[model samples]
Target chain A: MRCRAAVAALWMLTVPALGQHQHHHMAPPVSDSLQWRMPPMDMSMPMMPGLEDALPPTQPLLPSMTTPPQARPGEVIPLADGDTLHLTAGPVTRTINGQSLTMYGYNGQYPGPMLEVQQGSTVIVQFHNHLEEPTTVHWHGLRLDSRFDGIAGISQAPVAQGEAFTYELYFPDDGLYWYHPHLREDMQQDLGLYGNIRVHPGGEPEAAPVHLEQLLILDDVLLDKHGLIPWGEEVPTHALMGRFGNVMLTNGVTDFAIDVRPGTAVRFFITNVANARSFNVTFGNLPVKVIASDISRFERQAFAESVPIAPAERYIVDVLFPETGTVAITNSIQAIDHFRGEFYPHVDTLAFVHVQGAEAVPDHRAAFGQARENATVTNDIDAYRSHFDRPPDKELELSVRVQQLPLAIMLSMEIDTLYVPPVEWNDAMPMMNWLSTGAQVTWVLRELSSGLENMDIQWSFTQGDVVKVRLFNNPRSFHPMHHPVHFHGQRFLVLEIDGVRSSNLVWKDTATVPVGSTVDFLVDMSNPGSWMAHCHISEHLQSGMMLGFTVEAQNQPR
Target chain B: MITLLPFLLGGLMMPPTPGVCVWTPEYYQIALLPTRRVPEARQAEGAAHVSFVESPFGIAVTRAGHYRYKLELRVSGLREIEGHSYVAWLATPDLKDYQRLGPMPANNVLSTEVYWNKFIVFITLETAAAPEDASWQGPVVMRGMSRSGLMHTMAGHGPYQQEPCTVYGYY
Candidate 1:
């Protein structure tokens, strides 16, 4: 009996370690051996009374009240004009103590509308642009036709003011995606123009019942004393770092609270819609499990102390409520200089998970099956490293500069010639009169090495030849460079940083390159297509920091 | 008029004046009408009645009935001024205040070859206290100017030197 008890204790200790290794998909037997070294103890209960042996096996409590919204198999939903969706964009307006302001919206909400569709289903949406200017909707992270890519002037024409465009989107995968404007995107998105999308997996429903599921669209918004700040208004100087909103909101509510029963597992689909902010999100005390990222589900559930979500990113995390109390999920980066003055810790409460009920639900850790058998290598790591060892196929460098010129006197002289003198001129003009400096500053991206007006590259490669890209942020400039480097249609491995490899490296479509830092990544051009590699920062891209290279079909084209 | 003379004299009295060149101001006369006219009538009648006035500085446009238009002035017959540019903006009727607009993208000197007929400036004038026109129109005109030296450009791009030029119109 003592030996049996020892074996049971050893099993408990090794479970968590095994779980981590399986989630990351380290090597096979090596990870198994590493897991056996740890022992698991019942951390939930410190001590068990003598009557523990007599206790019956705990059963999961009667299924919680909430359940995921049902999606019929092969279901297709069509969103026509005049269908209203109720949503709020920023934190609870009442707590904000500012004038009620309106932002870009569809069905009278900032995020337009949420369009939920089943995988392998076609969704017909009649999109409309009511803003004064032209804008187009880009279904971000969605695999769609290049013509429907929604990049104004690139993939299609902008939806003119008061214009409507129809979309026939057929989602190929089941995951979390989002939608936002692609014209003057930095300002429009900041003014609250985004929404969440969920494509449910298609197939027979699994037997395991989901108790509670919710969609949490997370965003930070800058608000003025009156309310939502006006578009085109001059922002503060520190905005170069990033713009931190005066208010933070989840699902348009500041202090949104959710109720959950003890031990009830809930799935949350979280999307960060902030313009440039990255969220370090955490639940105050409840432990959470991440199940999926932007594109696909992970091989196994992974637990994280906090999840880091950059702009236009999404994650799905499952959490089991522990006790009957308020659990706060908030942005964990409080003191970090997130561009604004000082990071006000817990400035916004994403959502509150309130647990209720006495009986504890049986843990489903054993029944929760793995989503994928193995974490398949999406990118070739060794080939990626070797590509980094050699020189890049091509190098492109860009710079950002700021200077002032005399504008007021020139304007006055023109006015005089026009025969109408301005009402107020010639008194000592304030220093802030310059356009773009205090009120508006224009940033330019100029190619330094090649005088090529257009950034179009043509290259030929074999099926699996790894292409290396080396991006350097020159230090001679004054402003710091924070670029979200993005590649189209493929994922790449960040092989080296400066010159070293990191085991914790993860595959990503976009990665941030810090100021004065050089980052190198390699992509196996297995997919033959003209792909675009550009800075994901919408403002920087608008300022012309973009380039496109073609992965030609081998032996087919010049 | 006396206040305007002293301001003009003060501008001319700069110790190291950078080769001053003068041009005649063009003028136009406009008539204010109580009712909105047809597009053709508004264009043909307004243009026919407009007059041009030539001043020592440049050309000024004048017209009847709250007319609004733009004037382009070009400075010619001067060597390229190094590191200096002409700054201009609209001023109040008393010429004591300036409204910032934007800078003219040209070199410091006004040459007919550079800024065809000097710089193009916009002006609007309205007789009614509240004009219903969708465009800019207000009575009372004044213009402002200053000659920026090369040294001024050397110091950190001349703080706020790019403030847009403003234009005023009086009926």
Candidate 2:
């Protein structure tokens, strides 16, 4: 009887299962997804979990309560300072790469709508939730009023089905921001419920205006043969690694091509809205100058070959086409196969540029070629330069804990070892990755001092305090992966990564911390109100990897 | 407006007052060496030479292979070649065992850090966009040494700065 108890205890605890995996370095099967084998379906849970009906379902399209609606682009509602706009959350179907899939959209549009507002203006947004579940529109990367910041419990209650709530969004920074549901983003956001907000410089004449500009929302979806892959009914699927889609999308379509005049300098404002993937991409090897980021432009303009963007982060790059031809905008990265211990280059063309015409209007190649130095951003970060060496104010560990996972996952992960690479490139173990749902996995943002995980960690700061927080992603955890840590209602600077301080300091709301890495960010607690910080990966956010903190006046209660 | 900086190839900002440059744990200036590939007319144009700061990131660990300082490299006056790039490398003074810092990004700047006290910094022009091998298979175009590794780049500040940190022209 005692021996039986010991075996059962060992089965439940993953720490004891740390045995040696056979392959030290895995060489993946080349050129074929068919060669990759699947797992046994009789494990424990089905694609659709806890459904009352015991009827065996068809091959791919599982049971779903939401139906697909006719899809379209959310009408852009350009508002002046203090203007109001109406927004709605609903279900819609988007066809990607010739395949139609069901998704939860805003205002019947896949990427809701592009809300254009003037910088330094406060706009009132009346948000109505039409989805069956609760939702909230988080004005991501914005330092708006705390009441309108949009995390359900902190800013306001979750707007339930058929309910409406109002948000007074203030755009203080002149850059590209975004809006998306703050509740169950793993499903709501992954399906669609998102949009972009472009805040133009408030009434200021352009320093260096461009002939043309474009906003590109980069996204992806997981699809199968029958229809859209089913989402977990009880908890979020792909809980361990987050959902990596087979289909990639740009501005809600696979075929995202735009026309430009030869020798034209077009400014491209790119935002990554994917659930987990970090795209290391380039624009047809064009003469690309990185101009701005999430909140502010760089102090100095730079030319680079690729743009590596993490989820929820924004980058503004201007590309110059010296001659006319077809230019393919693509995301290419050397992805590692954890199971195989080999690297594979994954390249997907995000969009295309048909530059095959004479300059219709006067192009800005000459003006764009001129060097740009934004002294404002450079001078702004100088104040924090004195505090870089200060001891960290807080240390948070980004890690995952698991319970009730099947024996196969436990054993496989044990062999895979506790130490994994800094990044997970693909859905290497699809069946096991998805099966480790929220019921069995819990990603945490634990405060090291108090040993508090997630919301239990309460941090308070003065309105003007530059709080330095060190985030260490534990490499020893099972299924270790990258986490894009994002803070709400404030702008922070990435001070350092793995102990090296930042040389080029730009204001950012989100930053990616690779596995086995240590990152320290100094949050400019200028906004006084309740705020939250969490990993921006949609599935990780839904898996309880979040915490809420309050920012009071410098003289407020200690 | 976008234009080339006033030619100051040999040194930036009056040579940072040799041996008297600002040296706090927070911010520091790097003494960049002139590269032969860059013509005398280009100045500090073709390679990285600029700010090094200890931003809000924490103190460097004392353990081996732990970084204690960072350098933000800004390169200008260069053009891009298809599938080719300027790869950054940090190596020991003996020219053995290098850490291949990946290719410079679209911004023409390499955001980098150093865990070693004495090392050689070189930027090689590689045929590929990103090279995965440990050994660089390209020709070195620009080079600088961190003999005054951490703070001695100020020319005469610490024990590291017994040697001159800056050499104006390649000749």
Predicted structure with the largest lDDT when compared to the true one: 2
Span of ten consecutive residues with least summed lDDT in model 1 chain A: A422-431
| Residue A448 shift from truth in candidate 2, angstroms | 2.0
- Highest-TM-score candidate: 2
Reference contacts recovered by each candidate, as fractions? Answer: 0.00, 0.02
Which digits, one per residue and each the tens of the lDDT, describe model 1 over residues A430-481? 1111112222233333333454422444344554567776665443333434
Tens digits of lDDT, candidate 2, A92-190: 777776766667777788677898888888898888887878888899998888888888888899999899999988888899999888887877888
Question: How many residue pairs in model 2 have overlapping backbones?
Answer: 11
List ranges where model 1 is wrong by over 4 Å.
A1-98, A120-122, A202-210, A233-239, A298-301, A334-347, A358-362, A365-373, A376-399, A405-466, A474-476, A488-490, A496-507, A523-533, A549-558, B1-171
Chain A TM-score for each of the predictions: 0.65, 0.86
TM-score of each: 0.52, 0.70
Among incorrect, acceptable, medium and high, the docking class of model 1 is: incorrect
Candidate 2 scores an iRMS of 20.7
